[model samples]
Target: MTQTLDITDRTRLRRSHERGHFDRETINAILDAQPMCSVGYVIDMKPYVTPTLQWREGNHVYWHGSSASRALRNSRDAEVCLTVSILDGFVMARSGMHHSVNSRSVMLFGRAFKVEDPAEKHAKLARFVNGLFPGRYEGLREEHAQDLKATTLLGMEIAEGSAKIRTGPPKDEEADYELPIWAGVIPVTTTVGTPEPDPRNLPGVEMPEHIRKFRL
Candidate 1:
């Protein structure tokens, strides 16, 4: 894959162009750091966006949903936009207009394709689970054929996208910096909390290392 993504009208940043990045390294890093994403697609000339979990492997990104989902059905072989964002901090400036967010976000545009082969779909699902919680899939019950049939996996190559990131203190006007009001960043982070075990878990079934060590 090329080191940088091709810049097209759709991928160009019209505002705050300084924050735009086209390198694959920056794009992949942001995608891997966040699993939750929103997918935008059109149906019958109406637009819709669905929130879902995403996983990346090599130069491709994948997301899954119910086979009966209207979004997944219409997204197949259709142009779609996938976006992932991570909020790092809230920028507080002297003026309300200067207040902003410190964040990293990526927007990708492509034609989504369905994973038609059952075996390939199954493997991809396992990879998705194992990617988040290593070795956890092996301890769980095997997936039923019906379960796999009810799930739909869609993927797109990471060929047309750009990442926008903002960090550090807010940018305020030179005159505003002298104002008496304090200005700084309030850091934000996503943290994993303690895991709660199922009430019905069998006796002597201990929490696996993968679960204990899992991080987002």
Candidate 2:
């Protein structure tokens, strides 16, 4: 049996309940597929949202940024919202009101904390790089002390979250479906192109397999 989350008032699905999911597997799948996430945090009574790259490990989600960022600094001990999404297709409907999009998204609520451990933070950073490009971390040199110190890593538990997904064609009014209008879905996806090496090169170095076949 799939484990389900307790639906609190804030996390409950008020409408289109069928499209809502609280299962761990569903939530994890969406998070794992997307590397970019928007994090919302409040600083000194002012609201702010910042976009950054993120990675997941177990029930925790981690993101990093320059240590100098005010939002990242304030988020160290504050409750925040993190969201990730992917657009699968566009749903065309006979009526404009019914036009929609097919997408999968996850929303998480938790208090983020700065990762203070040097060794742990280093490993987390490595995971972020290797997650996108397999075996590439081994090719890079060790992180400099100053560089590592300049980076700030934050982590939050996926204790409270929800996933909202929509797929297939648009749902139009019953009478509108019979009208003379073409309706279907236009599929969308993220693709990788050929890798371009840096202009300054020491010798002939071929592109790595991970770079040649990168996909999300």
RMSD of each: 4.6, 4.2
Clashes of each: 0, 0
* Highest-TM-score candidate: 1
Tens digits of lDDT, candidate 1, 1-216? 112232435626333233445367788999999999999999989989999999999989999999999989999999999999899989999999989888888888889999989999988998999999997778789999999999999999887777777888878989999889999999999999999999999999998988899899
In TM-score terms, candidate 1 sits at: 0.91
- Ten-residue region with minimum lDDT total, candidate 1: 1-10
| TM of each candidate vs. truth | 0.91, 0.90
lDDT of 2 by residue, 106-183 (tens): 888899988989999989988888889988888888899988899999999877777777887778889997899999
Model 2 TM-score is 0.90
RMSD of 1: 4.6
Clashing pairs in 2: none
